[model samples]
Target chain A: MKKYIAKRVLNALFVVWLVATVVFFGLRAIPGGPVRTMLGAEATEEAVNRMRAELGLDQPLYVQYAEWMLDLITLDLGQSLTSGEQISVMMASAVPRTLSIALIGVVVGLGIALPTGIISATRKGQRSDYVATVAAFLGLSMPAFFIGILLALVFGVWWGVLPIVGYAPLQEDGIVEWFRRILLPGISVGVPYAAVVMRMTRSSLLEVLDAEYMKTAKAKGVGRTTRLYKHAMQNALIPVVTVAGIQIALVLVGSVTVELVFGIQGIGRLLVDAILDRNYPVTQSVILLVAAIMVFMNLTVDIIYTFLDPRIRYGDEAS
Target chain B: MTMLEIRNLRTEFETQRGTVTAVNGVDLHIDNGEIVGLVGESGSGKSVLAQSVMRLVEDPGEVTADELLFKGEPLLEKSEAEMTAIRGNEISMVFQDPMNSLNPTITVGEQIAETVRLHQDVGESVSLSAEMKRKIIGASKASESWRRAIEMLESVQIPHPESRATDYPHEFSGGMRQRAMIAIALSCEPDLLIADEPTTALDVTIQAQILEELHDILEVFDTSILLITHDLAVVAETCDRVNVMYAGEMVERATARDLFENPQHPYTQALLASTPQVETAVDELKPIPGTVPEPIDIPYACHFAPRCPEAKEECFEVDPAFRRVGSEGHEAACIRREPVDGEVIENE
Candidate 1:
């Protein structure tokens, strides 16, 4: 198991390196340089050259790439060219807000999905199944930003239950206030994700419930609760876990739109602003961070699979 | 001394196609300490009948019986909660496909111990010997259930029960997993154990070993067994009484010895002839001529008439009731009650 985890960690490092390299090169490929965006279109060639030289853009791509790679190794993400602020410092503030929204969105998604899926599957043709199915379809059809707007209109503007815009830092405002602020955006992002998970869960559980082992469990006189939760659900979770892992990345990406609608300054919003202003380091770092998160989540899911199924031992005799 | 009794039991399923009667009107009984075999082809409703006894058949499948009794108490009248108390505690089941029968995620031992824990009660009063009472008390404790689980595993002939108990089903060989299933089924010392094709997924050698272990365990545990199988030889070797089922109905029933010696029903005779005997050499193997009738479109008169060699004109027009034949405790469903000669009797 140690060997397996070591190999996975190495693989994750390689993936993060690959993403960093791609983002570094890809950002430079764009027509407008960060110098042009910072200095404005009317800037003279000498001023552009001086600004470029100061930012070390005059150096060869290889030297710049090597220096950036070295800085990355030492956890030194350089300052933003546009704002002259530390990219790391900007990320420090934005990362937590984005992470909270994604995490809470996922928790909310699973919370709604698992039970609804199980109920829809077990009571297949019943009214509850139909209701869940219709609700899932509606959730899937609506976009995350649209849901956020709708929620803001109802809960924020009309009902006056929640603040319509802006984010609160948990450490500054306490957890309760932070949670109240995060809840709307989280649900908006979560609804679509919950629909995906719910559908996956229903289908996966239906297949598992039809398996011969499930019948064996039923024959053993296991109670309905034990049979569904203990026997059927555990087996059903393999596919659901895979889908949920992938959905985490989706939620992170979708949080960008949700963050815009809710006016939360998170990593997603920072990436958007960085792209517009052509802040190369911030854009590349934020994109690389999101990619890293996706890779890590997938790796975690694979590790969880080993724990869920004994038959799936990794780095054993067989590959 | 009867452990279970079923009278005119029928199991029907409502499907998109139509209402399919899986198990037609049937009467079956198992006595205390008896090994009864229910033999049938696939889709003959043997498994459905077993599920009906435990009320394990799911929605859209309806089970109705004139009387479904366990220990002379009507099971049909019992609520699901009452049935849950009886299940695994008073009556347990071992299923086919050892590879899948046991839950793959859990250790084999915990699966066995769970059955014990689910039904364990400390204050429930029952007449028991002092040793049995002490064992029951020990089993009621959470930690002691694991110990009892390992003991049950050992009783089923699993080697190194302590370590093996912690291993998942995939870690065990097919035979060992089947043994583990038997161990779980018998952990609570149920009065009846329903083993549905317990050896079907095993190798021939492993099949014999599992049957031997099951026989020995049954003797020691003093539990009645309802062994469901399609193998005639398995029934002959392991069962005292045998019921031959055809198309959701019992066509013949007798002591294993009598059924083997004087098989009366044409379907039973064909089944014996089709089975390859170890000592008998024949020019060509005789296969049963036709498949079982579809459940929804089962023949009104006789289900086996299409395949029976001795089927007469009446066999296609009338359904024969089960009748006592030459020997006591021997019964068969055939218009001709007498035993047939080697020559076939032409239909007129």
Candidate 2:
């Protein structure tokens, strides 16, 4: 098990490195350079050269990449070319905001999906199942930003029950207010994700519930509750967990639009701003960080599979 | 004394095609300490009949009977809750496929103990003896149940029951898993044990071992068994009474010896001829011609008339009810009274 985890960690590091390299080269390949964006249309050639040299943009791509990689190795994110602010500081705040929204959105998604999926599977062809199915379809079809706007209109503008825009750090605003601020955006990102999760859970559980073992459980005179939850659900959860792992990326991507709609200054919004102003350091770091997080989540999901099924041991079968 | 009796029991399933009757009006009974074999072809509703006895058929499958009695009490009148209490407590079932019959995630011991815990009200005490009271109290605990689980496993001849109890279903071999399943079914000391093709999935060697284990179970448990199988040899070896089913109805009912020696029904005769005996050096096997009719298209008169070579004109006009043949107890569903000679009558 230790060796398996060690191999996974090594693979994860390689993936993060690949993402960082790709983002670094890809950002530089765009038509407009950071120097042009920083100086604007009025700047002269000499001023452009001076600014380019100062930002190490005049250096060869490999040298610049190597230096940047060295800085990243020591946790130094350098300064943003457009804002002249520490990129590390900007990311420290932005990452937490984005992480909070994604975490809450995933939790909300699972909270809605798990019970409703179980209910729909068990009570198939019933009224409750039909209702949940229709609702899930609606959730799946609508875009995250559209859901955010609708929520803001009903709960913010019309009802005055919640703050419509902006974000608050938990450390500064306390837990209750922090949740209050993040709730709308979280639900907006969560609904579509919940739809995906609900569909997967329902289909996966439906199959497991029909398995021969389930028939054995029923014939054993196991109570309906124990049969469904203990015998069926555990087997069903394996596929659901796989879908949930894939949804971590979806939630992260959805948060980009969700952050813009809710006016939250999260990493997603920072990435958007950095791209608009051509801020190389901030854009590359944010993309790399998101890739790292996705890799880590996948690793966690793989570990969870061993816990759910003892037969699924990594690297043991081949040896 | 009769342990279970079924009168005119019918099981039907509503599929996209139509309501197909799997088990037609069939009457059967099992006496205490008797091993009865329900013998039939693959689609002849033997499993459905066994499941009906336990009321295990789910929705879309309807089970109806004029009288479904257990211990002389009408079971059809019992509520679902009442039936649940009776199931696994008074009666239990072993399914066909041992490979998938157990929950994969659970330890074999836990699965067996669950049946014991569900049926046996472990915490309730009506006795005054200190040891009895202690047992009653300990019954609710996991340790006590697990200990009983090991004992049940040991009863089924599973080697290393103590350590094997902690292992999951996949850890056990095919025959061992079947034994473990039998262990679970017999844990509550049910009065009637339903074995549904219990040895069909096993190899010939493993099948013999399992049959031996079953004999041991009969000796120790003192339970009536309704063994469902298509293998004539299995029935001939194990059963005391045999009910030969054709198209969801009992074609012949007799003692094992009588059924084998003086087979009366034309369908029963064909079944016996087709069976390859060790002593007979037959050049080729005689398989029964034509397949069993689809449930939706079963003949209204005699279901076997299309397949039976000796079927007369009247057999096509009217269904034959089970009537006494030569013996006092032996009965067969055929118009012919005298024993037909072993003639290879070609299919019309």
Candidate 3:
């Protein structure tokens, strides 16, 4: 197990390195440099040259890449080209802000998906299942932004129950207000994700529920609840967990639009601004971080598989 | 004593087009510690009859019986909850398709132990719902059932019971998995065990081992089994009495030996001839003429009339009811066995 995980970690690092190399070269390959964006075309050639030289943009691509790689190895993200603010600090704040809402989205997604999926699977073809199916389609088809606006209108404007526009940092605002501030935005991103998770759960569970083993369990005198939850649910959860891991990336991508919708400052918005402003350091760092997360999530899913199924782990190991 | 009895039992599926009767009016019983085989080809409703007895038939399928009694108790009148207690504890089942019947993710021992805990170690008050969280019970009790689980594994002749107890079902071979299932069904030493084609998916050698295990279980646990299968050889090896069904109804029934020796019903005769014997060459194998008709297509006349070689005009018009045949307790649903006014289709 340790060896397997070690191998996975090495594979993950190689992927991150590959992504880092792509973004470093790819960002530079774009038509213009950050110096010009910072100085504007109005600036004289000499002024532009001076700015480029200062920013290390005037150097050969290999030289700049080497230096950037060195800096990255030393855990130094450098400063934003435009702001001269520490890139790491910017990320530290932005990542959490983004991850917090995404976490809430996951929580809400699972909260809605688990019960509804189980109910839909067990009472399949019944009224509740049909209702859930219809609701799931609506959730899937509707865009996050539209859902965000709908929520904002209902909870923020119509009933005036929850805040829609404000950003609440948990450390400052305490748990209740933090949740209150984030809930609407969280639901906006979550509803669509919930639909996906719910569908996966329902279909996966429906298949397992009908499995011959489930009948075996029933004949063994297992109750209806036990058959569905204990006998069936664990097997069904394997696919749901896999989909959920992949969906985490979706949540990251989702938080970008949702952050804008609710006016929260997160990594996604920071990445967008960095790209628009041609801030090389910030853009490169954000892109690498996202890639690293992707690699990490994939590894986590594989590791989870070992625990969920003995076949994956012991099947090879024992042999 | 009678272990299981089903009289006038009918199982039907209410399909969109119409109601498809799967198990037509069927009367059968199993005696204590005996393996009573329900034999038929695929789609003959033998498996459906097993599911009906367990009340595990999925919907649009419905089961009704004049008397669905188990161990002298009327199972039809019992609530689902009451039935749940009786299942696995009083009457468990071993299904076909051993490869898929055991949960792939669960440890074989844990699966067996769960049944033992749910119905054996835990008191009656531990409602069926409590099965979801057996760990919440006292740790000592939990470990106690775990011990029983390992014992069950050992009893099934699985090697390294202590270690294999932790291994999942997929780790066990097909034959071993079937044995594990037998171990589970007999865990509570239930009065009746419904083994539906338990050895169907196994090879000949493995099939023999499984039958050996079933016989061992009968001696050790004294558990009566409703062994449903398509193999005449398996019934000859394991069953005491045999009930032959054809397209949802009991066509013939008798002692396993007598049924094979003198099959009164033409369908039974056809089935016996269809069996590939080592005594004959390959081409001598007599395949049944037509497939078992789908439930909806089954005629009001004798289910086998369309396929029976001796089928007469009246055989296609009127259903033949079960009538006495060669020996005491032997019955066959064939008009020839009936003492009608006219000697239609003279005795051969």
Candidate 4:
């Protein structure tokens, strides 16, 4: 088991390196350099060339890559080509906002989906099931940005209950203030994600409720709640967890749009602004961070499976 | 004494096509420590009858009986909470598919332990202390249930049972998995065990071994068994009394000896003839001619009339009621079968 985990960690590291390398070179291949974007189109050729030399754009691609790789190894992400602010400093602020949004996306999505799935599946064909089914359709049909705008209008503009724009960093403003601001955008990003997971959970749980094991459990005199929660859920959750992990990665990407709607400066907005300004270090860092998160979540999902089912933990044995 | 009694029990399902009767007015009983066999091909409603006794049929399926008793207690009158207490404590079941019958995520031991803990009193439980190698089970119920799980595994003749108890269901072979299920069902030591084709998925050798072990295991618990199977050979060896089901109805009921020696109903006779006998030539082993009639909106007729060689014109018009055959306590449903003195005949 330890050997398998070791192999997985190494594999994860290799994937991150591959993604970082691809994203780094791909950003550099764009039509114009960060120096040109920084200086303006009407600037003299001498001014543009000098700015390009200062930013190491005059060097060969491999040389620039080698230099960036060294800085990466030493935890130096270099300054933004346009703003000249340290890319690492920017991440200190933006990464937390994105991380909080993603965290709440998971919390709210799973929180709503798990109970809704269980209730609807157990009470199938009832009014409550119909309500949940209709709500899931609405969540799926409306995009996250639209949900964000609607949420902003109700909670922030009309109701005047919460802030509509901007993020409060946890360390700077404390948790209550941070949560109060992140909630609107967080739920907007989460609603669509919850719908996908709820559908997966409902269908998967229904399938599990019909499984032979559940009948066995029932025949053994397990109570209705015990049969649904204990016997049916563990098996049902395997598929839900896998789907949730994938949806969460998509939520991270979807949060970019929500961030724009809410004016929260998360990595989604950071990546967008950096891309338009042609800031290579900031863009590359944002992409690498997102890649790392996806890789980590995948690893986490697989590890959770091993705990849920010993068969995966003892995978080396003959069946 | 009767362990379970079902009188005129009928199970119906409301589907898109209309009401489909699965078990139609079936009458049966299991006496103390008796092993009864219910023999039928697929779609005969033998399984539905078993589920009806336990009230396991859920939405869209309905089980109604004039009299349903377990240990002389009115089963139909019991509330669901009371039924839950009876299930696994008074009546237990082993399903057909061993591979799918168990939860794959849990260890075989935990599955067994859960039932042990759910039904067994902690004060009565004795754990590893019986082995004299490890410390006895703790005061906690969990340790005691775990001990019973290993003991149950060992009783089923699983090798390395101490270790095998910790193994998941997939780790066990088909035969071993069935044995594990048997262990689970027997762990609670209920008064009755409903084993539905428990050994059908196993090889013949493993099948025999499992049935033999089940016989011995249930003997230890003094548990009655309703062995539901399509295998005549298995019924011939293991069951004391036999019930033959044909298309949702009990077509024949007799002692195993009487049923096999002087088979009466045409369906029963046909079933006996279809089974390959060692004394008979290979070509003589004839398959029963027709499939079981589709159960939807079945007409008021002997369900086996279409398949029976001796079915008369009247057989298609009236359903046959149980009538005495050659022996006492032996009954067969057929239009031509002799009615016992004072036994009510359905038509004239």
Give lDDT tens digits, candidate 4, residues B1-348: 999888899899999988899988888989999999999999999999998899899889999998899999998898998888778778999999999999997779878887776788954332223321111121232487889999999999999988898788999999999999988898999999999999899899999999898789667999999999999999998999999998899999999999999999889998988998776566776779989987888885899888878878999997788888867878888977866664743422
lDDT of each: 0.86, 0.86, 0.85, 0.86
lDDT of 3 by residue, B218-266 (tens): 8988888888999998998788899999999898889998898888999
Model 4 chain A is weakest, by summed lDDT over 10 consecutive residues, at A310-319
DockQ for each of the predicted structures, in order?
0.42, 0.39, 0.66, 0.51
**Compared with the true structure, what per-residue lDDT tens digits does model 2 show for residues B77-108?**
88877887788778888889999888887778
For model 2, chain A alone compared with the true chain A gives a TM-score of 0.97
- Order of candidate numbers by DockQ, starting with the best: 3, 4, 1, 2
Model 2 TM-score is: 0.93
Clashing pairs in 1: none
Of candidates 3 and 2, the better by DockQ: 3
The clash count for each model shown is 0, 0, 0, 0
In candidate 1, stretches whose alpha carbon ends up further than 4 angstroms from where it belongs are: A38-47, A315-319, B120-142, B336-348
How would you order the candidates by lDDT, starting with the best?
4, 1, 2, 3
What interface RMSD, in Å and to 1 decimal, does model 1 have? 7.2
lDDT of 2 by residue, A1-319 (tens): 8889999999999999999999999998888988788788899999999999998889999999999999999989889988789998998888888888898899999999999999999998899999999999999999888999999999999999999788888999999899999999999889999999999999999999888888777777776777777678778999999999989888888899999999999999999999988899989988989899989999999999987775677985552
Among the numbered candidates, top DockQ falls to: 3
- Order the candidates by TM-score, highest first — what do you get? 4, 3, 2, 1
lDDT by residue (tens digit), candidate 1, B209-235 = 999987987788899999999999999
The stretch of ten residues in a row with the least summed lDDT in candidate 3 chain A is A310-319
The Cα error of candidate 2 at residue A198, in Å, is: 1.3
Which candidate would rank higher by TM-score, 1 or 2? 2
Q: What does fnat come to for each candidate?
A: 0.50, 0.46, 0.80, 0.66
Second chain alone, TM-score for each candidate: 0.90, 0.90, 0.91, 0.92
